[model samples]
Target: MVGIVKYNMAKISGKVVSVLAKRGPGSGGTYPGHIFTKIGGQESISKLASDLKIGSVLITGTNGKTTTTTLLIKLMSNDIQIRKSYENNILNSIATALLTQKGDMGIFEYGIRNLTYGIPDTVQKLIDPIGVVYTTISQEHTQVAGIKNPFEDYYKAKKLLSEGMQRGAIVTNADDPRTALIGLNKASDVNINYYGIEVDNVEDIGGEDIECPKCGQPLSYSKHFLNHRGVYTCQCGFKRPEPDVKLVNAEFNTDSWKLTIEGDLFNYTTSQNVKFNVVLSVPPFGFHNIYNTLASITAYATFTPKVENIESTVKEIFNNLDMSFIPPGRFEVVDIGGKYVGLGQGDNGDAIKINAMFMNQFVDGPLEFIYTTPDENEEEIFNDHFEVVKSMNPAHVIVVPGRKSIEKAKEYYEIIKKEYPDAEFYPLSYDEMGVRIEKLTELARDSDYDYVIMTGCGEEQAMWEEIKKKMINR
Candidate 1:
């Protein structure tokens, strides 16, 4: 119910708002997109996107969407006019793409929250992505997925991305049994490309209990990597698909790692001899990112045309990249007056578990844990994460209240007290940013604590900014 000229005007206004918002106080990332969605709606946005010549590439999953999207953008050839939005919001993504429309290709990270209805209603109809990458599936978004039987709801919701994908290529992780099944179910209709990490002595641990999609039977795994992801087999004849793109013979070190990526398409060996100057949330850099790296490389390889030697092609594509680049807030490490502090921003319980275990490993001595959540509904997830953090036997633990909910803070405190009676608990309350920085600074000053590790499901960016600002001043 909108005219072309009106839509254009709305888009311009949205961009202006975005620019103004960015220059002002807060991150203007999602505001412009929100304005565009509110004013123009999906119909106008879709009409505007119809002019895209190169098609779109959608990246969506529980974790690694931003990192994967960023890597994919870097791996892709420069000539492709790829439009991407860092915002995970659907409206923001649509607006950003329409405003910045260029090149033949569009790359977007569609958040998992929008999978059920957002994909079918907006992305499928608008971007009509020729290619899609699903990073991994975990039970997240409890409110959206419903409280009871949330896993099934989350799984089905995530599958909507593939179902809505334009019959081109859908790349997924082979080790992630849930997403692998989603790809297999669609293999008959779509080009399902699978990629995963292949390593020896990979134990199945700390993953959701995976069940067969076909039958409600429990799945078995020879090697479970993280959570339910591994070489899974079911009695209903569902099994993990062999990856078309695989990173084999992977090895990790304290400062560096090595990868030998092999598949039907490409055979390449790459090593991180020089530490990338950042500590990833998944430490040793091989735990989770290896999968993300393989997925990105494999997805890009498929997107690119037939190359007889994918190894050379990969080297050529990524040769110019700053290998030192770190995705913001994943596992961001900062020095606050010579004290090494790391931030592990987990998006879900599994992510929390993964990062907690890694952070526990990489720390030299006496690690301090700071935990925060933004929503009360995430208490169950918080409990799961707190259990993992507790298992790490941190030197001290700080339970910060959620953004606006003190009640949830109290609940989190109870969980900590009930589980770890003797563990040190600091229920410090900071109402202002300055107060938070001051309190955290005081804690860092203590030589007793080796390093402070902050883990938050939400409110990571705000905390990360505060910590960075403190470091800058120090």
Candidate 2:
């Protein structure tokens, strides 16, 4: 077994994986991981993870794990030998652990299905994480998971890391009721910290809120950030917990926002707390990323205590981070033929709604929207935000093909046409990714518009890179 493990580790290495990556698009990053696990097994993973000096951080939730982990690495990169995983699957995570030579701390996002799929067992056996973050809980992949209640099943999945952590800090999104409830239910011995944003108006926009799980009563919100996330309450006396790290008095600037943070920072290792009053200047992105940033900042403070010069430390951290840190295909902008095109990419309906809301509220111009609709099952989701989209008053609407089928795209186009009778609807055939971007660019160049907003999900996600390449060359 030892000999086999060594041979597999040698064969399915980082170098080998990089070579495979260059082969083709279908050659996914996770392929080498699958081969590594098949040959080396859990024993190999354990051996590789044991070499890390600072252990690892396991971040899990329905959304924002990737972005939050990215931010965590950025904030903590200076002090620890931290490495991050863009891929959340445990197989790829283990393969990453084996391949990277000097990663003392692993900042990895675990997929929500890891617990249900029995992958966390391998993760737990390998690096008993030093810190765990539950970003938010929402309905996702119910059909694939073969579950009826996405909220219940997914809640169980996300709670695994908190329950598994024997002696480490756990960060929860206080604005999210499910995560807040889970944090409240944790053992008293566990170190828990919460992060949330305070806002003036709380509307039930995305409509993901069901009855309060504890009280079976309607949920109330003082501020609603996104679907099923906000400062919430129930008739049975349950309410959103006060966050340890909170963002308050957010005032928007031209391309940025000024916010004040009033909280006590807790060092995960020392169990020490320090009070801080610091104002931050944050660059612009979608609203969801604000929560992501807050979650990342709180997670960072858990491990890192403030220096004597707290103001400088806070300034340094915020100065380094901005909307630029957001991953590709999310509120990404490109310049093509003297036109600014904004691309919002997401895989789910709620994400689309949030992106639309951001564009509606923050952006101004004669807007042209090229909307790539979701699958048949989720077709109506965009329509839920139709009022918001219509309020943006897009001059022209272009319908691109969806992941499910061309029919799905046409279905959405028809639906959108009925809603906005005045707006032009141009139905384009689906082709290669480059072809799609080229068509969109040509139309945007010819159109009278200030911003060409392209929103896509699933298969249309591939267009993000092609669009970027074309725009850069132009």
Candidate 3:
């Protein structure tokens, strides 16, 4: 009884913080939750979460979590009120949303790098979410906070997020074996809704080999839709799960894409079967966003209380959708006075490949690749990134340090020099991020090549987005 009183007092104090935090940047998003946790403790989080009458849903994965969460929030918001948060993927962000937002449901994007940094199990227990959405998972951060985080441990950390759930639904990507395995393993404990692409028109021409999550042997892909995500089977008898929600057809154009998506999934709120088939016309947001579209739609169908409003709401939101829906610092192509430049964050191999694919569509002739090198202990990421650079067949390559380690960046550049003997290297210090951003922007802007693609490993907002803003506003 005393604990309840204390929690109420903490909630009131958190609310006051939320109301008075000046509402700028991270302060409004996470400070309230931090104060609440400091005063009422971590145990109080569950009580705050319980305020949602329909419970919460968390989106997590290597990529696409923010985009998927944003789309899901839009879809669900049309049907019912929802408390939501994204970009800042920590618990405090969600806690702040809970304190300030009034809604029946809570939607938050949660990112897990590894077990030590991300407490997935504890979050699952505290939030007690009714739905946990998994975007495609792949290797990105090989090391977290100077610790070597193996792929096995990273995969385990993602699994722990939904492993303890006894009710609700698991919305996952059927095309990605890692996420499919998670849904398959949890089929007995909860409702599993898988989303994927079924059309052959969209296929990845080349990609790296992926190991089967179930078996140690290499998995065989019948079709590759995106990097490490495709229709595949293993010797251990594990294969891609049939998608409950899928993109049955897609019509790609220069400006927009037409997607025919179908969904038949169990709604956790209404406890009934719901289905919808709708063709949405959306901005040419890239192939990765196709998965994001399916993920958000599947999750919305799985949790929305208004089942009958599914088709209308989806069409309403997506048909009129714009490129603005994409989160900041993601890949986007811009025209700078007749020069076509594609620039944004491509921190991981998978992400870099996608950015390349997107930029390929706009490359007419003589493309210059402005590459950013990863930091120390990230040789694996460098190797994957180098593969992408070679595939792009740029007329020129410029390498700069994307992270703090200028020495490691030099090492990576030397290897590139072997293949492209003319490749130039700039040992940009991480301390002077402003100078780095300026040089990167200048290289892409003043380049002789009409087609330029600036992407690799870099801070999403601070580096890439800033450079993009400078080039656009120049």
Candidate 4:
């Protein structure tokens, strides 16, 4: 076994290139050093995978992975010295668990885009994970692996996640088709747990009928709320089973980041995504902070069943959530001489979609927006942020252009003049930006426009800090 593992690790290693020549035509593809490193490391890795019960829970699917994983970690971290990991898509807690003595429980997440990065082989080991959570399904990486059927793609990845689960449980969104389809037959021998909102039974959004050892078929409606979940019926007929449970209902308030499930309310902080109805909210992400919190509740409640500790842990997290989740841009308020400003990147379209676009949540009346960018040519940068600028409806949109930025600002001013001819666009000189910012603060005071937004990169927080200090000192 040792020889086979070493040989397999080497077959795809970089040593083949060194043997080809010290300097070869396609040498960039693999380095001989990488081969040596990987070969030398296999022994330690195998031992790590085998020695104990490293409870791992892989959070996958598109949307709620971050929210769910974050909340799950929050619930378990207080008592169990849990380890975590991230792979761009989701935190890779498995990696964190392997590196720490305290990490007896590994709760990690992964980003999958079909064949391009099929589920990693480590997750398929029978004893690998004691738990798992699937957030939801949507076209996260449609073009990556050429998966024509979204549901089928979801099933394949799910099956791989549950492949070796002999002892631990598999948790799926009982409401999402992507997860619900991975039924008991998928892994009859392993433990399986299903969770959906109580509202789903009422709304008829989740679950279906089966002999569903867990729930019956024809999948009669208990209730359904956001997506698919609720009471279900089967030919054999079953309804929500005991112990491995279902939440009664959920209400999420985006503005305050408050979540209420089964009449038990929890307040989340700004860092919490409000659309946290895990299985219902899909990829690219929506503000489901509440759903994410609830999913954590469900996952912990269903698998662990140490109800008292789990419930107490959740209450503890909520108590600490407010302090941990606020002041995302490092502070909550940005002020300058009696006026306050909000900094923005305006680059992440999803936030805008939820906050401004669909929600019609833009501010009313005169406000100032200082948009900056590296497009030295101000005209390009101005044009680039045109949509956001237009959306801000600034009383006087100031383009703090960099070197070579005036042309762009002038172009925008001309364009704005053609319609709201009274509205103006000002291009501030690079050397006098601080002076210009002060001038804007004075204008804000004179005009009674108390709210300002500084949009761009890196400069937002610093400028806001100065603005706050100026306002305080004034």
Candidate 5:
């Protein structure tokens, strides 16, 4: 009884903090939750989460968490009110949304770099989410906070997010074996709604092979959609799960993309079967976003109370969707006068490849690749990124420090110079991010090549988005 009183008081105080914090600098999205957790303790988070009548849904994975969460929020919001938070991927952010927003459901993007930084199991227990969405897992952040987080441990950390859930649904990418294995393992404990691409028109040109998550042996793939994500099978008999929601057909054009998606999944809120098929005309948002669309649609169909509104809601949201739905600093191809420059954050290998693939669509003539080198202790990322750079066959390559450590960038540049003897290197200081952004923007803008791609590793909003704004505004 006393604990209940304390929690109520904490909630009130958190709300007050949220109201006051918003009037000042910064978004203050996590401050109230930080204060509330400090005062009421971690145990209070479950009680706080219980405020949502329909419970919460958490979106997580390596690449598309923010975009998927944003789309899910839009789809769910049309059916019912939803408390949401994205870009900020922490418990405090979710807690702040719960404390400040009034809604029946909560949609939060929860990023897990590794177990050391993210308490996935604890978050699962406390949030007790009705839905947990996985947006394609890959090798990202090999080292977190100076600790070498192995792939096995990283995979385990992602699994722990949905490992303890007894109810609700697990919405995962069927094309990605890592996320598919998660669903297959949890099939008995909860509903698994898988989403993937079924069309043959979408295929990756070249990518490295990945090992089977179930067996140690290499997985055989008949088709490759994205890096490490495709239709595959293993000697251990583990293979891609049949998708409940899938892109059955797709028509990609320079101006727009037409996607025919079909879904037949169990709606958690209504405890009933729901199905829908809709063709959406969306901006040429790239192939990665196709997966994001399926993920968000599957998650929405799984949790939305208004199951009947699935098709209508999806069409209403996606058919009229714009490039603005993409999160800040994400990959986008911009037309500067007649020149085509594709720029944004491509931190990891998978992301860099995706950015390259997106940029490839716009590259007609000689393209200058303005590459950004990853920080120290990120050699693996550089190796993977280098592979993509070689594949692009750019007329020229420019290397810049995307993170701290100018020396490391130079080292990477020397390696690139071995391949392209004429490749240029810019030893820009990460401390002076503004100068770096300006240089990157200028390189893309004034380049002799009409086609330029400035992407690799960098701060998503601070560096990439700022550079994008400058190039577009100029």
Candidate 6:
């Protein structure tokens, strides 16, 4: 029941997304709206508070919230209406929401620390009066949350989502077992809209093949899209959602992706999952970008038909259509002194793990690899993740010596050395490392394969700043 003048609407994902393509002031054109109103909710909120202007959508979860929020806001913006801001994290979410409604509908992205982990009550209250977007429940930022058991912490965060917000607010992501278990209860009064990846595609390194949230049987994947998402069917006969809209037969082309509605099969790509093909998350960056793109876009498509021109519109939004990575980190190549250096970070953050979640796309290649371990600042690196790095058997790993470097970083390298004995170890201070890094980057810029990455660096923030400065001068 969101207040709508019903000026005009468009079709997307066939029939997904709606609402105001533009709102507030200064908002000119329209894109797709992913929110739906029952017809009375608007009045209800208005009655709840005359101050009630537009409800916000807080897309929070352990992973993909930022990227997903970015994509949703981007797709949600067409010629005129657009998302306001992309804040640093959940702590700043509310602040971003207040900036400029100017007639444009508000779509806020919130980040939660495990559950009730980092944010104070006031921030929680902010979400209370907004639209709810639960990205997914997974293990992340446990130290700050004080929940070593990531699942429980993540699950608790999901439950906490219901404290604020109206009845039956738009909620998606049926694939998350924790979602149905916790969110279903908190949002009991709210209408439920569910979307999941392929059931059989469940690769429960820790999060899939879960019992039916309702029926308690092994869920079957009607088709696994990507990650823990796809169509699901329970023995009790509840299927992943008929999906008024589906991201069928998603196709990823390394740098970009394409998606289509289900019925367009014979005319489109041969994948049976036609309705769910691959499309860039918005700006359409690299492979990792695809993960967040699918979730939010699919759900948005469900409620709003404004996403039809998504592929075409994305090009316009990206401004610079290059899938640029945050350089000196994650697949970075540089030219220093005419020598090529491939640089990348092997941070143990959970998002990097794509064993089952990512296949060929997350390849350990580019010919040469120069691994570097950073000083741990706050987040500690778990041993298991480093073991995977060792398994890669790169040419060399340089553990930077610094006060901020993680205590265990060197220890983990010790672990890798046991497996990769010949792996040259150059324990250099930041000054020498910086100069050497320059030389590597210079070569990487020139040669086909010179520099690769400085894996497992905890002091990356400090390093990235220095690198940025060097690039500017160069």
User: CA lDDT of each candidate?
Assistant: 0.65, 0.66, 0.91, 0.47, 0.90, 0.44
| lDDT tens digits, residue span 17-114, model 4 | 34553432211222343453366443433444454344666777655575577777777666566656433332122422343324556666665656
Colliding pairs, model 2: 202-224, 268-302
Write down the worst ten-residue block by lDDT for model 3.
20-29
Tens digit of lDDT per residue, candidate 2, span 1-474? 347547556446644765565322212345555556566664666655556666667788877877887787677765556656754445565455445435567677777563456455456556677778888776554444333434466566677656766777788888888888877877475678898887654254644665786767889865667877877889988888889988776776658877777768667655678666778887766577777878877887787533344445556777656566666556566556557776656556556666676665545667887776655555344554354456557887776664545676777777788866655554455555556667765665566776877775544346665565565576
Off by over 4 Å in 3: 24-27
lDDT score, candidate 5, position 35: 89
| Candidate 2 vs. true structure, TM-score | 0.83
Clashing pairs in 1: 54-104, 81-103, 203-224, 204-224, 206-227, 207-227
TM values, all candidates: 0.82, 0.83, 0.98, 0.52, 0.98, 0.62
* Global CA lDDT computed for model 2: 0.66
TM-score of 3: 0.98
RMSD of each: 5.8, 4.1, 1.2, 12.2, 1.4, 10.8
lDDT of 5 by residue, 65-104 (tens): 9899989989999988888888888999888888888889
Predicted structure 1, TM vs. truth: 0.82
Reference-based lDDT, residue 283, model 6: 32
Off by over 4 Å in 1: 1-41, 77-79, 114-121, 144-149, 201-208, 265-286, 305-313, 316-324, 334-339, 373-375, 422-434, 444-447
Q: Cα deviation in Å at residue 157, candidate 2?
A: 2.6
Q: For model 3, state the Cα shift of residue 230 in Å.
A: 0.9
TM-score: the better of candidates 4 and 5: 5
Instruction: Give the alpha carbon lDDT tens digit for every residue of 1-474 in model 3.
Output: 229878988989998988887664422589899899888999899988988999999999999999999999999989888898899889998898888888999999999999999999999999999999999888886889888889889999999999999999999999999999999999999999999999989989895569998887999999999998999999999999999999999999988889999888888889998878999999998899999999999999999999999999999999989888878888899999999999999888999999999999899899999999888999999999999999999999999888888889999999999999999999988899888888888999999999999998888888887988899897
Top candidate on lDDT is 3
The global Cα lDDT (0 to 1) of model 6 is: 0.44
